[model samples]
Target: MIEILSPSEITRARATGALVGRILQTMRERTQVGTNLLEIDEWTKDMILEAGAKSCYVDYAPSFGDGPFGHWICTSVNDAVLHGMPRDQVLADGDLLTLDLAVILDGIASDAAISFVVGQERDPEDTALIETTRRALAAGIEAAGPDARLGDVSHAIGQVLSVAGYPINMDFGGHGIGTTMHQDPHVANDGRPGRGLRLRPGMLLALEPWIMVDTDELVTDPEDGWTLRSVTGARTAHIEHTIAITADGAEIMTLAPGASS
Candidate 1:
């Protein structure tokens, strides 16, 4: 369902969004070569509980995915892109890792994701992949406002990724997020502008732009039943932010406390 949150609800949404941002930032800081994926999940759980918040993903079971994610966060490593279920795998240098998180605070939910290299050994291609997602996310956010159409955001994001030569995956894109983790207004990565839903003030949208290096296809791990990996095993990157539309424009709700940008 598409929800147009009230002013008070929007206020609470900021809290949820910032919490998500801080948790992700903390995860990035603690992650390194040799760190286990399960370790990341545990840390996330401790922080969420300490904050008196609830994870939107722990009990999340949707038709497209295997029942109940059963994890605190999504740890997508290297070729893995979305719905990556954390496991016992240890990170290695130069591994591309994406941490996607969402949570409910004061009954409002917000979601975001970040992709980064694990260690000091950074491959130029990996670095480019992560940077491209960042730029695309920024472009998508810039295209959003009270007067903008959802397709404008998608077009902006697609423009950047396409120019960078990465194939966009349509299976999973952005979506409306408010009282729950996922909602209406499926925001595709690429689409025609000036079409689709017209954004309204107090609306919250989670805009994520993800791409695979050489393919648009995705394959799920049979045993894990989650982890969406590139069919070609090429490196991938994903970045997301929960945005709140205002009378003037869009404000990024997921920037961590004390973040300059």
Candidate 2:
């Protein structure tokens, strides 16, 4: 369902967004070589409880997934991209990591993700993949404004990734988010402009642009049924943010307290 936030609801959304952003930033800082994925999930749980917020993913059970996620955060390392369930693997130097998080505070939910390299930089391809997703996310956000069609945002995002020589995957993308983590007005990574849902004030959207290095194909991990890794084992990256539509433009609600973006 599509949800438009009331003024009070928007205020609650800001708080929820802030919490998600802060937790992601903290997790990114704490991640390094030798850090366990499960430990990261524990940290997220502690912070979520301390803030009196609810996890949007811990009990999430969708058709595509195995069952309840049972994890506080999504940790995608190297080949893994989306819905990566925490595992026993320890991060290695130069591993490309993506952290996706969602939380509900005051009944409003916010979602965001970030991709970065761990320990050290190894391959230029990995760095480029991460940068492309980041740039695509920025382009998508820039295209979001009151009265703008969802296609405009998708077109902008797709143009960035396409020009950078990355294939767009439509299987999963951004969407409307409010009281729930996922909602209507599905926002694909690529689409024709001047089409799809029209933007309006008070509308909230989570714009994410993710890409695999070599192909658009994805293979779900059979064991966990949550992690989606590149079929080619090529490195991947993802960047996303929760934004609120406004009369004049889009307001990004999930930026960390001290983050310039």
Candidate 1, 117-229: lDDT as tens digits: 98889798988888989999999998999888988999999999999998888878999999988999899999889988999999999999999899999999888898899
The parts of candidate 2 lying over 4 Å away from their true place are none
Relative to the true structure, how large is the alpha-carbon lDDT of every model?
Answer: 0.93, 0.94
State in Å the error of residue 188, model 2.
0.2
Clashing pairs in 2: none
lDDT of 2 by residue, 50-158 (tens): 9999999999999999999999999999999999999999988998899999999989999999999899767889888988898999999999999999999999999
Model 1 Cα shift for residue 12 (angstroms): 0.2
The candidate scoring highest on lDDT is: 2
Model 2 scores a TM of 0.99
